[model samples]
Target chain A: MKQWYRDTGLQARMFLTMFLLAAVYLAFISFLATTGVGTMGIVVVAGIFIFIQYFYSDKLVLWSMGGKIVSESEEPELHTIISRLCQIADLPKPRIAVVENNVPNAFATGRSKKNAVVAVTTGLMHQLNHGELEAVIAHELSHVKNRDMLVITIASFISTIAFFLARNLMFFGMMGRGRRDSGGIMAVWIVSILVWLVSFLLIRALSRYREFSADRGSAAITGQPAQLASALMKISGTMKRVPTDDLRKVEGMNAFFIIPAVSGSSLMKLFSTHPQIEQRIAKLEEMQQKMEF
Target chain B: MGFLDAFLGKTKLPKSKTKDIFAISTANVTFEVNLNLRALNKAGICFKPQASSHFTQARAEVEELLAYSCKDTNTGYQITKDAYGYTWIVLEDPDFEDLVSNIYLVSEGLIERDFGEQLLCALFTFKEKGGANVYWIYNFKHGNFYPFAPKANKERNSAFEFRLRSVMEKELPIEKDVERWYPLWDVPV
Candidate 1:
């Protein structure tokens, strides 16, 4: 399992993906900065928003999911498992909360691990056995340990701002341009739209890679990659039969879903928030076999 | 902190000398003030390896020793297996000192019988941080003691674990090998 962490090939790929994302972000920001489209002002406002969200993301996510922060008294077994996993992962225990929803899912949220929160639905508690539950929780803890929340949050922030700029360029251009230099304003809008589209795809690709990283993290922490692989299989199976009505209401929260809400479409694989479960399971199996050696 | 750290061979040896159980007694006060945990008067013996004829005789002999030695201590003992197949001999008493003494005596007896290899851990139970549930985990393999401070919703207060380590290091032979701190998880009661 530890060997997986030291895999230079995997690390090189991860670093390369990160480098590409950085390049894209820098190019977008430079374009906006050079064009004098109030990008600096937008960047300042977005920075403040991201800062606030980063600090309060765990609490906000828990609240948004209708989760209640539980004390050790409220859930001894759950606390025990998380604490043990945290010890193995060499992380401080993140805050634990439980969502009232009956969908079997779990997620980790926070800007950093110290402030992270690991929340699981009541349905998940009823679905998995102790070992399997530990595997799932360990997986979420892996996300926390790898600082995936911070990466994903930052990635999404740039894309989100790009999206806002693209959609509201005409409004901003009108406010700043006053019917003069219409060609310049048109070019600005086109640039913003292009930035938005490109950043959106890059953000999703980065997200997918982070998921793979978290899977590896989970396998390492738990020392039982097979348990997590099985858990993922079970989760994906349960996800399919889950009532879409309840899930649809929470569709906007798909970015934080444990198994991203699956929409039945051939195109879903291309746009889904998470990698296909089969691929994730296969990766875990590969690591499991490596550990056996 | 790296993957290599996880694969290193675990070193096991018989505890060189039996420490007086009086050390664990001090934790009652330390736990309350520092960790906000109440000592649950439940000390459990954890042994690894599946049950076999030799193990059964060793366990019985250890139990006999404890019953005879603790007759005046008023510590009640019971041997049971948790869901994970780890064997535990639980000793309950209102007096924390008596509980500690009983645990030490039993551990010493098992070691004397050459069954020390099967002795995995001895756990001193504590209530969860915000509630009245208990967690007692003793690592016999490491010969070092640590606390399992569970939170209300099933999380551990690792900061508290570190604090406990700092405070209790001088008082007990704490496990120096970090890997040996394998958590004794999911013990009933």
Candidate 2:
């Protein structure tokens, strides 16, 4: 019996979410096997593409965000803090990157622990205090520890194939990507479209759950749940005044962000890549009260 | 966590490990004789506060015990709230052995009370021949000791600290990383 506790039920929730996604992928594959050989070919091609993406995701995402990996000499304070947090998290020291923007956001990107890169915006550094910054870094390191990217990438593999098939079929006028129109072409197109839509939602939901798990992980690593919760609130509050134009620019990478750029209360709540700030903060505050006393 | 780590059920092993601080008492002889440093006869234990009653009770008990135990040792202890919100149990005694024993008692009491993880670092203040300050900081989290000799704001006496570390390496488990020699700036003596 341990004296302290935080919410790791989020881990089980992520697993269940992935399990549901795996089931959906299994059904899609079973349906595809009945359709034709073209579907299997698409699967093979998607696997290769996913493998490439996984290997170079850290570089690709950093490039896309105009982020650069910094050396220890250049950002010794950042490196020192991250290494200390990693020591607590029991993880390898991941590369630290910095993005020269004012959006007040931070993210972790990589396919595995060894290949992880944690990037933060300049605004975040200017905006948060030491404890807040440390808490945010702990959150990013938690994501690396969780390997949420790898889990989602594996989940997305089959969905990407289905998406490739569906999009190409739509472009090729209901034909199977320059292949002979088998009688089951109509069925494959419908199944592909359904799989694409459903998998997209499932991945988003899993992503949200993983965010919760990472929040919990950060609290555990730092042993200061309130610090993380306050940091989230600070970031989210700062995010609102960061100019909607700037927010929209990187909104595409919302899934990888500490706090998404979305404003208050959107219609896309169900499709949100991250949980609501209020919900996350409430959970953390509850954890703080329960675990501290 | 990796799939293998999860499969092996290795989730969340204890993050912090605490080592015996009595080593410092033995190492004091080497530091004084070899490095020409003498204990200022002042030591302090730092810990982060928790809101738990158990922690509060343990802190109260430790303070009471320290007060009672030091009544005849010509030693005095002070409780200070540092600027960083970390609480310090500062002890002073002309006899270095009494200071070390007092710190050991407070630390052991906290450990027995299940609040050991909250213990941050134990500081044994020492002085050079010319009255320069050097600290042997025992990191409770990492279970290692380090020498911190801070000169003005954020500036470190790196050369001297490194030499002290090299001299004391065999006597104590010196923290290998220079970055982790977290300087206790403006620590209330």
Please compute DockQ, using alpha carbons, for every candidate against the native two-chain complex. 0.07, 0.15
Which candidate number maximizes TM-score? 2
Which lDDT value does model 2 have at A120? Answer: 96
How is the predicted docking of candidate 1 categorized under the CAPRI scheme?
incorrect
lDDT of 2 by residue, A77-186 (tens): 78766765665455667888999999889999998888899999999999888777887887888777766777778878888988988876655544444545655676
| Reference-based lDDT, residue A64, model 2 | 94
lDDT by residue for model 1 (A29-133), tens = 777667745555565676788888888988788878998888767886787678655643456777899998778899999887678899999988887776668
C-alpha lDDT values of all predictions: 0.68, 0.76
Error of 2 at B40 (Å): 3.9
| Stretches of candidate 1 exceeding 4 Å from the true structure | A1-9, A238-267, B1-81, B84-189
